[model samples]
Target: MSKEFEIAREFEVDATPEQVWDAVTSGTGGWLWPMEAPEPRVGGKGPFGSEVTAWEPPHRYTNRVEDVEGISEQTLNQLDYTIEPRDEGRRAWVRYVHSGIFVDDWDNQYDAAGRHTDFYLHTLRQYLTRFAGRPVTAFATFEGPEASSAAGAFTAVARALGLADDTAEGARVRAEGPEGKPLDAVVDYRDPYFIGLRTDDALIRFFGRGHWGHPVGVSVHDFAPGADAAADEAAWKGWLNGVFSQP
Candidate 1:
């Protein structure tokens, strides 16, 4: 019989409970860097047809998928979040629990979920630390060959973007990527762990720690009005897929 899986995590952020609450609630799309819930109240609509099941200001929130298009059948999928004041009310303590049923490929699915949870939480921390309250949009894509090493994945993305894998912060950069899209960016942040590029239209980032310690991923935080997010996502996806397929 197919079984179910649950993943839970906790994270501490240098932001207040109210700040974290806004990010979890309606203010996420702006800085949390993904599709956001337009309305975060009970009976309100959210991303991917998710509806708010529980809502408490600056304390707790829960959402569940119901009749959402593009959702895969799994038997169960729910996200519960709890936020509290910590560090003498100077920081936020958060809990995330995601539980769902998987009819097949339980191992890979669970691993990916856990790692992605980590990555997204890291992104949230970065946002709260440096870019909170700034307008932003996010697009992410994953690439495969589960055998690929973290360093190798980082190299591929760096080469594809015409930048050094170990680029230093504050370096002037001009590169062209797949689909002949031109990128005139500055190397803003770089480390053995992550890379960030600042461009005219967006802040781009690539993570070497692909989900589950394999596959590589890139996320673009676009700020332009009327930007075609779907097309941009497709372009990057195709580019990364092609890069990984190369011998």
Candidate 2:
């Protein structure tokens, strides 16, 4: 584990620095990943067992996450986020960096993290733009075959569901599962990195990234009030398992 691997991404956000700060700090930032952290400051606890190492509001923040032991043991994992004002207070720019040491497999681990980061950041933008300030019921889960074994399964599932390789945002999508049930959902968002679908009841997001490449996760955000999130989670779990299980 002498060498370290890094993954970095940059994004332009359509919000003020103060607004982006709140979105990443106090507002719906935690909701983006369903993790809790203490207030942003030095020595504060961050999501995913990370501890805040540096904090500068409306500009920069960084954390070092706990060593991940499973799926081949990684060490010294650090995440840094930098936000800069843009468009004369109408927008902001963000840079995200994830660096770590892997004991054994470096390429697989790095690629998985890269893909996951892309999806998470996209979701953050979606939250800030469309769903900000709205109460949301979020449900997330993981599936099997590990990333190592299922490297391309994410795209496979999309193709199996009849989505073209060029399916992008605003594309009308329709497909059927192994059980002969139709998936009548629109392409709310799509990219080589990920795909998001919006049904009448929920917004479903699927990502190619997974822990060790084994999982192709689907997140559910119900739009209706008093929605049974637990039940929705269970239903999606079953439905996705079926969709991904196709031959």
Please report how far candidate 2 places residue 64 from its true position, in Å.
1.2
In candidate 1, position 43 carries an lDDT of 77
| Residue-wise C-alpha lDDT for candidate 1, range 1-247, written one tens digit per residue | 3567888999898998887877767554544455665475787775666778888887888878833254455456778899989988799999999876755667977777776676567657666665666666545445444534445577767777787655677888877666867878877666554667766666666766653455665677666666666877787777777777777
Worst 10 residues of 1 by lDDT: 66-75
**TM-scores of all models?**
0.67, 0.79
Query: lDDT of model 2 at residue 198?
Result: 67
In candidate 2, which residue ranges exceed 4 Å CA deviation?
Answer: 27-31, 69-74, 144-152, 159-162, 174-193, 198-202, 209-213, 244-247
- Clashes by residue pair, model 2: 146-213, 146-214, 147-212, 147-213, 147-214
Best by lDDT: 1
